[model samples]
Target: MITLTGRLICADAAQAALVQLYLPDHIRLTRAEPGCLSFDVVPTSDPLVWQVNETFTDRAAFDAHQTRTRESRWFKETAHIRREFRIIG
Candidate 1:
């Protein structure tokens, strides 16, 4: 299994708005993917920061998720946001 834990840092309301705008679809699509064990993104106390947690059946699953995200509107809109993450497999 592979698990990813992260925080997406949004600099301002604009970035946070982008996240809110796209995150629902992103989460829904990711959770529907084959091999996805669990996926979630939730706002932190800071409001502008979001916590992300994802688990997959294996590295291949994780890689596929990455590929999909890179092609998604969520990634295109929030690409500039800073991410702090750790991966365990």
Candidate 2:
């Protein structure tokens, strides 16, 4: 299995708003992907930070997810936001 853990850090309220606006679609699409065992993005105690947790069947699945994300509206819209993440297998 492969897992990703992270936080999406928004610079300000405006950036955070973009997250709120796009996250549902992002979540839906990701969850619908094959080999996606689990996917979650949720707010932290700090409103500007969102915790991310994802699990996939293997490296191939994880890599595919990454590739798809780079081409997605979520990536384009939130490109300026900060991300602190790690991938584990």
Candidate 3:
């Protein structure tokens, strides 16, 4: 199994709301992908901070997720946001 944890912090309130507005589509598409064990995005105490927790069946699954995400509109829109992540097993 593969686990990915991260935090995405928007540049400002407008950007944060933009991310929140598109999260539902992002979650739905990601959850529908094969080998997706779990994908979660949670709001932190800071309004601009979004916590990410994702799990996949294996490295291939994780790679596929990364590829798909990189091709998504949500990913492109959030490109300027600060993101930090770590992979674990």
**Model 2, poorest ten-residue lDDT window?**
58-67
- lDDT (Cα, tens digit) per residue for candidate 1, span 1-89: 99999999999999999999999999999999999999989998999999999999999999999999999999999999999999999
Q: Residue-pair clashes per candidate, as listed?
A: 0, 0, 0
Tens-digit lDDT string for candidate 2 (1-65): 99999999999999999999999999999999999999999999999999999999999989999
Best-matching candidate per lDDT: 2
Residue 76 in model 1: shift from native, Å? 0.4
Model 2, global lDDT: 0.97
**Which pairs of residues have clashing backbones in candidate 2?**
none
Better of 1 and 3 by TM-score: 1
Residue pairs clashing, model 3 = none
True lDDT of residue 78, candidate 3:
80
Residue ranges of candidate 3 with Cα displaced over 4 Å:
none
The global Cα lDDT (0 to 1) of model 3 is: 0.92
lDDT of each: 0.96, 0.97, 0.92
RMSD to true structure for each model, in Å: 0.5, 0.5, 0.9
